[model samples]
Target: MMFKSQRFFKSLQLLIVASLLILPLLISEEGLNSIISTKAVFKYSIFCFIFLSIHFLHRYLLFPKLYARRKTILYFTSLLFILAALIFTRPFDRLMFELRPKPNQVDAPRREPPHSTENRPPMGNERRSGPKIDVLSVFLFLIIITIEVIIETNKQLSLTTQRAISAEAQKTEAELSFLKAQVNPHFLFNTLNNIYTLAIIKDENTAPSIMKLSNIMRYITDEAGNEFVSLRNEVDCIEDFIALHKLRLGKKTTLNYEVKGFLDAEKKIAPLILMAFVENVFKYGISNHSSNKLIIKLAIEDNILNLLCQNSIYPDKKDTERSGIGLTNTKKRLDYIYPNKHILEINDDDKLFTVKLTIHL
Candidate 1:
């Protein structure tokens, strides 16, 4: 379809050019009769054919194969050769006129009164053969070349931009996949460790904890690889994660997890984006010998989602090396997925670690 449309437009352009070239002859004293005459028609046709031939040759062949490929000398040489050819061929119509039979003219020469060279009008043949190179024709040829060059340059630029954009998109996708892969294993390892501790202690909650892990795993397996998941599903997964942690919580630990706003079914979020913070709360903020308080709050209003997670810090329980990886990956994911659409602030003081995140849906 596109090729057909392009061909149609090209044909229309050629027709318009041919008409413009022939317009002068059509508007002369003899008007349409002069253009329809055999000599006039033949001369105009030859000119149009040569002009169009050069136009296409330069546009498709010379530009693409030589000039565009940086063959500067050869390309310019080709242009000069074409110009020379046009200059040499300028008398082709006169040659044809002299060769053709003219039955109306007698073979014997007739004497005519000679006029002063300064005042006498020039002969028609003299006017036709004035210059080997027509300045206007040269100018028109330059215009054609300029227009083609501009069009081809623009086309090349557009094609280059599209390729660059495609490459960037693929890179972003690969990075996101790598980050998600890192997150899944880290989360599973921690969850399994908690379940392992429960099993070692022979706690009755072990089986139920395993069941909760099963649900969390199901969510991960089904939705973790997706770019976005429903807010409801994400909330359910977070709740399940918290429940899994609650099974092994120390008596001295107090966790306050709250969701203050209604969750919209249509709203969606990056899967597991909030889990890293929640996981850290259980990992480093709880203690069996000392009282520990952990608070997590999530609110949604006016198409914006906000999260606040605050936990009591334990100096002796800190694991610096492994602790930052999850948060680092999550931060990168947030930057990739939300960019300026989200704001994340983390504050770590002597006794408390606080995280605040705001996202525009």
Candidate 2:
């Protein structure tokens, strides 16, 4: 019902504009006085729209070779029709224009002066007729039409470009949000695993673990839901994530993590953007066991975030094709969301497994 109402209003607006356009060619000052008396500025508006719409329709639809011949033929036909209309309608329009509310005694030159056969050679001379045109009026009419067509076409083109740009912006925004949502679950699964591990251990630090989990969940729910969020919020979420995972890993496993320069308050980044590399650290870094095994470095400098995660990989045990959905989804999301903004490289061999993600926000 709402849609139909809107459509009806749109149709009504079109009708009003069209009516105003042709109104100048229709009613006269006397006739207008009979209908309604006011100083309403009824300018030539419809003729302008008709004139431009025809030109554009010609350029796009008719100018092509397939239709050019047909259009040329149709155009000649239309010119004939307009010529006939001018011949046929001019007298009527002039008659209406000349008509007064009160009666007049005499007519001017337009009142049809006597066909003076008596003045010169009466019966011997032939009647001479002028061309079927008013040169000055026709020239003015054409000039007005051309000027109006150009102005209206420019206005319409500007409106069309603005609408196209607005639509593209909306589509980009929707796709980016969907890309962000796709990575949220991977983070959730990891946090849930932490809670499960803490439960099995029955650790005293479980309360703090729950708090970290809450912060992570809240960050995902609240911050990711928005169109944009502060860079600080994203960094804090990453901090809480590493802290929670560190609790699970314990002091026995070697861990080295670094933080670089500050993230500006004005800077903003997509949510769940860096989850893939961090997730790989936990999934693959678990059984490294060597005294100098685990090493993960993340540093942000000059608006660039460079991270390197290195863990040990046993040749026989670990899958060289460590292809999984979480990592694949991360790669795809990075492409769609960041494009030229980031580079990710993963290198793995017998002794060391390394993944590096670099992004310039």
Candidate 3:
């Protein structure tokens, strides 16, 4: 229904413009007499038909096919061809309507003016007294056609911009969906592993780890689906994850987790964005005989969220493949969500691996 209404209005607008153009000619003194005479009416109808046909041809066909395509030679050649055809055929068309009534048979010979040859201008310089060609109407047709071309060009540009925006939106949605899908399974696996180790050792903290896991699962299922979540909520989830991992740590492990500066409730971040780095520490930093050190710090200063994670790696205990959506998906998510608003840097050495991330709130 909406489409039909729009098309109807467009047709009505075209009709109104056509009426405004041709009605003035019909209401003129010469035009009123032409309408009363059968021969003159036929000639006037032909002129109007040619005028409208040329106007539309230039606007719809010639401009788009030649001018818009940057075929400069072809465009000007076609324009000249059409104009020359119209100019040359006009005389033949006028001759067909030159049927004035003849005078009676008793006429005398005509005489020239008494002015001398010197007084009169030379034949080459003398201007013809007959009606000059009417080019104003042709110029008006060209102007209207050019205006139509400009309007169409602007409309196309606007449509292109809208399509670009829509495409970017769709890409962002797809990326977020993939990240969420990975987040759920990757998080659940690591949490379950920590609980499994506790159950094997028959530790008293096994039940507490399960409880923390339940709370973490609830938060992930609820908030990880969102595009952004409060910074406080993210910090709470990260703390819960750290507590669960601590159950499996031995006395040789030095795990220092700290959060400094104000964590404004209104400040939001992509869900589970900071958890990946912390998870990697528990996955690869622990060793059976070696002392391990892990440091995680998060600070908010002047609307900037700064994160630093550093962990010592035992040469014998380092896993060749640090599985689960560790850094790859994290980096991809950062690019999609934060883009130019975040900075990420990683420095790895023989003994330790460090990650620093800064985000603009």
Candidate 4:
């Protein structure tokens, strides 16, 4: 926008320069005496202004592409030089010089003057009988035009660059928002898996777990994208995740889970945020289940959620892969979305794996 304004001012400035320069040359007595009468000079100035204005306007407005290239500048400048030279030589110069009074000797029958053999003055006219081509003025005019063209080109380029930058910023923001949305769908997929497992085992806890999952999903669908949610709502989501995990395990496992303090269920997190530890336990603990014993503890103090869970190691003596999607994705989201506001600790021994998560709401 600034460039556009500059271009407009420059164009208007050049037009005013042209008008001011040519105007007095038509109206002044000295200018009229040197060439044609005032009326003819006025006509000439008007013709020159109209013609030049049309030429420039056509190139700049109607056919910008035509004047945008360097070759066009060279072509127009050369054409203008030729036009100026022709204006000097045309018969209009002879008629204007005839405005001067006849010589005093013309009363002696105005005899046909003999052609001079040397560089002598003509019979009646002075040394300069016609229009003069001032090369300096023509050259200066061309230079001014060239500068104006360059300025206009720069203004256009600036406008184009600004638009490109704005578009790129919008695209980057859209991509980041999309990646954030992907995390919610990931949670839903895991919940669906837990529900399917529960049906297979015919667990009595399935209905309640399903209801909790639905509520957590509602939080995700409606509110997770906002700036903040209460710490209480986040704890509710964690409880729901634990409930579903417990339902899938059924009577085959013994689980201890606890929460202290008045946990408000309105706290918000990045929706579906708490499944990381719950999923990790089921994958490496209950799935192996040498004894099927697990302990899950949660507490809230001073607006913080502290989660602790431990379970027996996999029975097949296999080391659980830390690179699995559930843990790795959770780790990334935690660092990206929670950053210094959250803490996570993992400990594993020959018999058990333990995880502790502390979140500053």
Rank all candidate structures by their TM-score, best first, as comma-separated numbers: 3, 1, 2, 4
RMSD values for the candidates in order, in angstroms, are 14.0, 13.5, 11.9, 16.3
TM-score of 2: 0.44
The best-first sequence of candidates by lDDT reads: 1, 3, 4, 2
lDDT of 2 by residue, 32-148 (tens): 453242212222222344433544443345333323345667655654564455455443233333332433448552343578444332121443243456442344335433443
lDDT of each: 0.73, 0.59, 0.71, 0.61
Runs of candidate 1 exceeding 4 Å displacement: 1-207, 317-319, 323-325
Give the total clashing residue pairs for model 2.
Answer: 1
Kindly report which residue stretches of model 3 are placed more than 4 angstroms away from their true locations once superposed.
Answer: 1-207, 314-319
After TM-score superposition, what is the CA distance of residue 153 in candidate 2 from its true location, in Å? 21
- Local lDDT at 350 for model 1: 69
Candidate 4 lDDT by residue in tens digits, 78-115: 55665575456443343333433335564665344697
lDDT for 141 (candidate 3): 52
Q: lDDT tens string, model 3, 1-361?
A: 4345446544653664476456534545455443555765676667667766776687568877888789989988987787777666663235223323223458883455776455332333566344455354445455555666665565556566676686588657655655545444545676688778778999788898898888787887788778899999999888988897776678989999999998889999998889888887777777778787889999999789999999887666565665544687678778877889999998878788889999997
Per-model TM-score, in order, reads: 0.50, 0.44, 0.51, 0.41
Best by lDDT: 1
Model 1 backbone overlap count:
0
Two-way TM-score contest, 2 vs 3, winner: 3
Judged by lDDT against the true structure, how good is candidate 2? 0.59
